[model samples]
Target: MNNNPFCLPVFTDKWIKHFNTSGQEKRFDFIENVSFVKKSFLPVYINVGKNLTKGISYKFSNTGKDFKKKVFLLYDVPDYFELDTTHNFSSLKTIDIQQYPGYLVGTSQYPDITAFKKSRFGKSSLAKVNKYKRKLESSFDITYTLYYGDISRETYDLVFDKFKELLEKRFSEIHVHNNNLDPDEWEFYYDVIYDMILQKKASIYVIYDGDKPIAGSINYHFDKVAIGAIMAYDIDYSKFYLGFTIIHKLLEWAIDNGLEIFDFSKGKFGYKTQWSDQEYYFSYHILYDSSSLLANLLSSIMSLYFRLKVNLRERNIGMLKNKLLFFFKKKKKRATKDYKISEFDDTIDSQKFSKVSFDVKTLEYLKRITYDFLYSRSEHIRDIEIFQDLNDKKTFVILGKSAKQKVTFE
Candidate 1:
C-alpha cells in the first residue's frame, strides 16, 4: 500500500468507487487505479492520487520491466517531484519536467482577519462591501452559516440541490451550461460530498435571505489545508455581490478554525487573488524506462516533442492568433467601408429606447469595432435585433439614444 498523503487506501478506495461506474453514463471513464495498470509496458496515469484538485500530476507508471517498449509518457506531473526522493520504482527510465505555474493561497500570509481584509480588499473595499451588505439587508433578513462535522441528512440534500442549481444558472449565463454536467456526474459528486460530510471532513457555508438559502460553498478539510471544492450563488442576488461575500466569509471562517492554508484549489481568476497572499506551482513530466537503447531514444524524442509543445502553448500562441486575425479583420473592415452605408431608420424609436435593430451583416461588422467605438455607448442600447432586408442591401441603425451617445459611427 502506498503511504503517500493522497494514497490513503480507505479514502482512495471510496473516491474511486464514487467516481468509477461501469455503466452507459460514464462521466469519469478515464479514471483508473494506478495499481491496476502497473503491469502494463507503459502505464499512463495522472499524478492525481485522490487529494489534490488544482495542479494535475499526470505521469506514466514505468513499473513494468519490459524494455522492448521502453518509452512511456506521463503528461501532467507536478514540478516539486524529486526523483531521488521518490522511491519504490525500479523501471523508471528518464524524465523531462516542464514548469506549469499553479497558484494557491498560503496560510502564514495573514495573522488575522483584519490584516487579511486590508490586504485582500484594499482600504475602501470594506466600505463598498458594507454598502452591498446594507443594500441586501434592506430587502431581506440576511444570515451566514458555515456547517461542519456530521451534518443532518436533510440539510445535505438541500445544499446539494441548491448548489447544483446555482452552478447551472451561473454557467448558463456565460453560455457554458452544457459543461455543468449530466445527472450521472452529479450523482458521482453527490456520493463524494456525502462521503466527505459523513467523515466530518467537509465544511458547507450558506447565506440565507430570511429562511431561503441564496448562496453557499462546499469546502473540504484535508490535514491543515481547507480546499474550496465548489461555490455557487443565486443569480437574483448577483447585483448584491453575494459570491464575493460568501468567499470573504469563508476566509474569516478559515482563520477562526485554526486552518493553516486556504487552498483556492486552481485557476488564476481575479477573484482568487482577492485574498491570496502566495501561490504554489506544479509541473508536467514525461518519463521513460531506461532498459534499452531504443527506449532511451524514444524517451528523448517524446521529451523534445512535449517540451516544444508546452513552450509554444505557454508563449501565448492564442494571443498571437488573435493579433494576426485582428490585422486581417482591419484590412477587411477598411475594404468594406467603400460599401455604401445605407441608414434604414435613424429616427430614435421612443418605444424602442432599450433596443437596437440592425441587419445580420451589419451586426457582424459592428462586433469588430464594438469594443473600441461602441462600448461606452452600449448602455444606451438594451436588446439587439437582427433582421433580413428584403432589398438585399445592408443597413446600419442605432435604435436607441442616450446622453452618453456623443458620436455617430454611421
Candidate 2:
C-alpha cells in the first residue's frame, strides 16, 4: 500500500500535471467533492489516484487529529490497510467500505514462481502453462523480452506503438473505449515510462513475434512489489492462449528478479483471480469531522452514494452499464463478411490447384486459425504453404509438412 506506484515519484509531477491539464486544479484539496460540494464551498481533501484506478499513498499526520476540519475522500484503497483503526479517528468519523475486488500474487511467500503458481492452481496447471508457451513458441518466431532500466529509444518507440495498437485493437473489437489510448493518458505513459525505465521504476515486457511486438505489458515497479498495470495481446495469437503465456512469462521474470508481490491492481478479471494467491478489495474511505453536523452528513451521504454505486457495479447494473456504453459509444465497425475457415487440399481435390498470388488481405480473416494451425502442428510460419483450388476459389488449402488443412467461406 505504501509503495503504490501511482503514488510514487515515477508519476510525481506527471500525474498532477495531467490532472491540471484536464482542467482539474491541483489546489482543489480544500474542496469536499467536485460534483457535490462544488457550489457549497465546503472544505474537503480528496486524495485519490488517477481516475481512482489506484489508491494514492498518503501519510497520516497526527493520527487523524490534524485534518479533522476537512472532509477527506479516498477510494480504491486496498483492504490490507486498517487506516481507520491506526489513524485513531477518535475525534473524527471515518467510513471505509469495500469497493473493487483485487487480485495479486504474494511472490515473496514462495521459493519461486513454480511454487507460487502451484499454490494457486494444482501441479497440472503448470503443465498447461508450459503447453501454451510451447504452442506460442512453435506458432511463431516469438521471443519474450523485458525492457527495463536500459532500452533503445527506437525499440521503445516501436514496442510502445505496438502496445498501444494491441490495446486499441482489442478494445475496439469489443466496442469499449480504452482509457490507455486516450491522448492525454497515452502521452503521459509514453513520456513517463521512458524516464521511469531509465530510473528502473517501470518496465515493458514484450512478447515479440520475430521483429514484431505482438503483445506487451507495462508494469510499474516500486519497492518490492510490481503492479501489473496495463497488458494486451494480439488477438490473432489468442488461440494459443497468449494471455496465459504472457502472464506466466511475467511471473517467471518477477520471481527471477526477486519481486515480492505481483499486484494485478484493481480489476477482478478471471485470469487474475485464477492465477492470484490472494484476494482483497479496494476500499473507499470517507473522513470528516464528526463535530461538524454538515461534514458528518456530507460524509454519510457521500459514503452511501459510493457504497451504492460500487454495489450496483458489482451486480447487474454493471452489465447494464456496459450495454449502455456500447449503445452510446460503440464505433461503427467495418462491414466484413462473416469469417469462416477456408482451406483447399490438392491431395483430396479432383480439380487442379494453383499457386497463384494469394491476396494477403484475404488472410486477415484467417490469421487466428492459421496461427492456431501452426501452433498445434509446431510448424514454422515459413514452412506452411497456401493454395487455391481451381474448382472453388473460396476454398483455400494450408499445406504443412505433416498434413494439409482446408477452409471454405462464402
- Residue lDDT tens for model 2, 58-160: 4444422545566777667677544434444565667877778888887777777768767777678778877888877776788888988999999999988
List model 1 lDDT by residue over 242-269, tens digit each. 8778877887777776777777765456
Error of 1 at 195 (Å): 1.2
lDDT of 1 at 4: 24
Question: Residue 204 in candidate 1 has what lDDT?
Answer: 85
| lDDT accuracy of residue 311 in candidate 2 | 74
Question: Deviation in angstroms for 131 in model 1?
Answer: 3.3
Candidate 1 off by > 4 Å: 1-6, 9-11, 18-42, 46-101, 177-184, 285-287, 292-410
Clashing pairs in 2: 30-44, 341-407, 342-407, 342-408, 343-396, 343-406, 343-407, 344-396, 344-397
* TM-score against native, each model: 0.60, 0.86
Candidate 1 Cα lDDT to native: 0.53
lDDT of 2 at 218: 89
